[model samples]
Target chain A: MTLLKNIWEWDKRNFERLRRFQLPHRFKQIGFALFLVAFLALLAFRFVNNDATVIKTSLKYILLIGLLIISVSKEKIEDERIVQLRQQSYQVAFVVGVLYSILILPLVNYMADVIFKKESLGFEVNSWEVLFIMLLMQWFIFRMMRKKCS
Target chain B: MKNTLKVERAILNLTQDELAKEIGVSRQTINSIETNRYVPSTVLALKLSELFKKPVNDFFTLEEND
Candidate 1:
């Protein structure tokens, strides 16, 4: 019982410490701007230098990092309800992201192969893509839930 | 959980926004709690109790479903 209690206390303390590290509300806007610039740059680069895989990958990472910043930033009103909704959104997004990567993507690849009458096109879902999907889903669900609650 | 937050606020003639400001929460949070869409944490409950000069039990009650 004492060990369990100590562990609970440690967990609670770390959770509070993590909360303190959240970025201010204004960071969300900065994150959005970064994401937009990276996305547009990626598109322009793709047209200009189609074979620039390294630069394209770097741009994608920048976009994902921007999203991560947005996800970690605090809301204007960072109350208990908002925290709860954020946690719920993360949970839902994780489950959906895993399912999409493991099931939906594979199924779509299979369908495409059958339609084209070709061998496996070596289509694979990367971790970055899964992270992007999860972040997008989290943002969408969080906004929807906030709207509903309001 | 069911709460008499709406009733207490009404009795105090306080708008949701006003009460929310007093409790350091967003207006939507007060609205959600009153509408049964959200259950506040104990800290928030105690803050409300303190502000309203009532025991937590007076304003909050557990529903059978809860």
Candidate 2:
């Protein structure tokens, strides 16, 4: 019983450690460079080939991964102010994202009817688009607010 | 809230980086507090108090707007 208890405590500590873990500054910098290059390369390929299928499949994955790296990476000095800004970013991103999701359906319908001239409207929105937009908003707002605050 | 953190640090002859190290926070945090751009938490306030050998109220006080 004591051994089991010790194991549980150790596992709990490890879980907490993992929960608070962040990548080193150098690794994050390298990740930023690599992802930027990959994104530009993919974009150029899409522009040249004009392949809708390939672009639809691979572009989003690179975007999602790059956004994840941006969000997860730590600053040179991750202090209380930065943490507060992060909280603000999350709150703003969530509210904006939900509002966008609500408004986008009607906008999409309008676009389909007027722009696309489609008779049959089966409006299905992609979830990744919303996620990407939310991530972009978070990044933009966080940077802007941080700049104003600091 | 308003604080005399810059004055206190000056009295102690401590740089922002040194004070931040003693307080287990980043230098930018100390700078922010000094510039009145950010407020420290209760625990951080107490830590500053302990480091400066002064009461929390001596370092921080409420302004009319606060």
Per-prediction TM-score to the true structure, in the order listed = 0.88, 0.80
Which stretches of model 1 miss by more than 4 angstroms? A1-16, A46-49, A121-123
- lDDT per residue as tens, model 1, A28-107: 99999989999899889967956888878889999998998889999998999999999999999999999999898888
Q: Which ten residues in a row have the lowest lDDT in candidate 1 chain B?
A: B57-66
How does model 2 score by TM-score? 0.80
- Top candidate by lDDT: 1
| TM-score of each candidate's B chain against the true B chain | 0.95, 0.96
| Residue pairs in candidate 2 whose N, alpha carbon or C atoms collide under 3 angstroms | none
The Cα local distance difference test for each model comes to 0.91, 0.82
State the TM-score for model 1.
0.88
Question: How far off is residue B40 in model 1, in Å?
Answer: 0.7
